[model samples]
Target: MMKNIILITLLAGFGFNLNAQPLAPDFTVTDSDGVEHQLYQDYLNQGKTVVIDLFFTYCPPCIALAPTLEDFYESWGGGTGDVEFIGLSIMNDDFNSDCAQFKIDHDVSYPMVGIDGGAIPAVQPYYSGDWGPFEGVPTFVVIHPDGTVDFDPSNGVYDGPGVTGLLEEAIRETGARKPYHLTGTVTMPGGNAIGSFDLNIEGELYSPGQMLPGGLFELDILLRPDSTYEISAVKSGSYNEGLTTFDMIKIRKHVLGIDNFQEPWKYLAADANSSGGISTADLIQLTKLVLAVSDNLPNNDPWGFIKTDYLFASPANPYEEAYQGDARTYMF
Candidate 1:
């Protein structure tokens, strides 16, 4: 065990305890990218081993060790592997942008959180002796999937390559499993790519929906293996994009049976109240939305997702005979 140690170089005049906390305390912090990560829910509960590197923006040893940490992060599949790495700012006033810039300067690819991103409070328990003894900057902590903390996991080896090796060995000792990935492109019926949209992911672990930017959806989010997820894509705002008086006429006709919708999705789209059926009420709601009397439809989103593979029981009239269907469920 002594040979496997990576002694960390402190910021000078500071010391660390040889003993680590038996159980890791939990925390939630947002990263520079505005992504929220929770310790127990997002990683450990999902069976991942997490390595936390705590440092201030200008710490000398932290700066020098950045690149090696980046290499270590990539070795674990850049957050897609069983191991996840995060850099946290120990300073109380470092902004999210500061952490972002620090990562750019240090060429670190892993997630970095700063004071504005909730790093201060997140790290307080560790260094304040609430969790255990922690005495300095540029400290490395490895938390196993079992929620056990391994402080000074690198055995105080401050050198880059050696520290990386020790951290890897420590992670391997935890027996973490590779993460599952939730990834795919979101597009409209006409194959129009959506640049940004909200994602509601629910499964063994529930993450509040976040509007994932263009790159992340396809790049994939790590998920718990063998767990099921119900995903929904929602795009809102621009409440009256294609609505007009002429469309209102079409709805009126469909309601009166003078002319009916040809496609099942048309009924889903035309049902402005989400009442499961088309009627004069839908036409009135459409009229209000189109005329700018109201900015939204009653009980309905500006847009709703139907599974790409969903097949309506009644193709011509989706609402025929109290239809109960899978149109509202999505999986990736």
Candidate 2:
């Protein structure tokens, strides 16, 4: 057993990570849904930067990295077909079933599976160095279009700019785009922030981003010159009350990020300004409401968006008119 162990250790030294020279160790793994994915043929072959998340189910940091990785995936020229992402569970035990359950429970939209059933396990020991000191769960490594790997950010791997900064770095490094900067905000009607939610800059406008905590977003992409593009906000979260003094103060607090709000009001809703952001202006609008200087606050909404189901309701339906009797025209 000792001799066998020594031999394996010696063999691993001659493996994939022996100074990053070998072409990105190719592998084929099937997702729990039985969909086959190739590390090179499917991604690097199609001119897309391949990003793989090496993770495990039991790791907390790994779990925390899931959403951020998703956001990064979507923001980096996502819908424009510039990038692809996959998750590989590095669990060295029987975790195929756990991998499937982890995906469902976490609402993971990306492909995920354990390493043992695929070619990935072959290279794991080398890259992971026995899954020791350098084993970073949810380790995000990128494979460039030229069939090169971006394991170390410091090595000029990726350099694209804007949302998903690291990914843009990669895009820039690959010379994939000239890059146009698009920055904006997505807030509730009352000026209350949407917190964090996805925005799809479609018509292939390049990125699909989620709002920053301040309800702001920025996207830099290589769009067709003189061409128009469409942007859509992935309507998420609940619709709560956006009116009342409480709502106005909540908007103020949101803009301020004042967690220690004196009087500690319970918030149901806040964005009164329909500007897709919350700020002092929303507070002013609410002040107008309090003073009766204006009966209508711009947007008349403080919680969330009026989704298409309610926005594009039938005009011929009498109930539709009644439903919108108090609600103003849908805020964009």
Candidate 3:
């Protein structure tokens, strides 16, 4: 939803409608090391968020977003760190020496794939086979750690800040669950039961739903078993600006790449009203929390809001405050 409406003179075109799937389709892609990684198992399942930038080198916007994308990669690391950024040149002219030099000049630290063809499919298999001609450049997709495509490239991420905000939401969702067990039944369109159907929760697959002798049968799963919730909570009374209401406004500024701070986590942390985004309303609530007028935020006290990373690019963390940036300083 944080996408920009920019119809630039692109070298390529894309038209695809990707929705949130029960499980993100699988595909193998190799980075510079020639080590192929299964999009879901290798990264998403391992607690690494994914950002795939589909672009053409000739396009000015594509070239422009390159450095910002690199910053995003370093800001949130892959797997252990937080995010995995991949840049694919989806152009007709092969991504040869010229394209390679372009990346070098841009200082892109993430992996690049999809070269030598006007076609693309190996990356997002869900939309790979019969989706579209995909007539556009500088598009992107954000896959959550749970292997769900929160924002598919079909919708198109118009800019760096837009993509950055998407990544922050994915990271926040990762910290909300640690695989708690719950059960449910799968039914078909009619009154009949869809027995023995495999159940998927938070990306991971479960055994087929059991078929009982008499009437009702159910399946249970441990949700997000692989998720390591980095941001635990954004509570009140934290001296740290990143964790406190101070970062709330800072997050708004960062969404537009303003001020000295630029991060996806801040965007998620600033959404105090739980309205699905940070706005002036969240700032008002943050003001109350800071002034002791309120004890709880609408979206506060959850495991998802507590971002393990800090505002600045350094080792310093939050003080011993209940809802601060430093995960180490957490008491609750």
Per-residue accuracy of model 3 over 1-332 as CA lDDT, tens digit each: 12101110101010223453455566666544344667777877776667677766678887887777676565553323556666666655645444566777888766666454212455445345343344467666666676666544434666778866665555455452222323332222123432343332333445634555331444332223334322111112332222454455465575455763334433444556546555577677776666667656655532232222224333122122213334322221
Off by over 4 Å in 2: 1-20, 77-80, 119-133, 152-164, 176-332
Q: Against the unseen true structure, what C-alpha lDDT does each candidate score?
A: 0.68, 0.50, 0.48
Ranking by lDDT: 1, 2, 3
The TM-score leader among the candidates is 1
Per-candidate TM-scores read 0.47, 0.42, 0.42
**Candidate 2 — what's its lDDT?**
0.50
Number of the top-ranking candidate, with lDDT as the measure: 1
lDDT (tens digit, per residue) of candidate 2 on 1-332: 00000000000000113244445777888777678887778877777767666667877766665565566556554425556667777667635677788877776667777754562573374374332234455455666777666563423212223224655465556545333565655544334454554444453223336656545566655643334444444443222323356655555666678742221112112334444344577577667766667666445322222322332233323233322341212221
Candidate 1 lDDT over 71-179, as tens digits, reads 7687567887788888889887788898899988989888899988888887776776644457676778888898887777665578898888777667766775433
Ten residues in sequence with the least summed lDDT for candidate 2: 1-10
> How many pairs of residues collide in each model?
10, 19, 13
Better of 1 and 2 by TM-score: 1
**Which of the two candidates, 1 or 3, achieves a greater lDDT against the reference?**
1
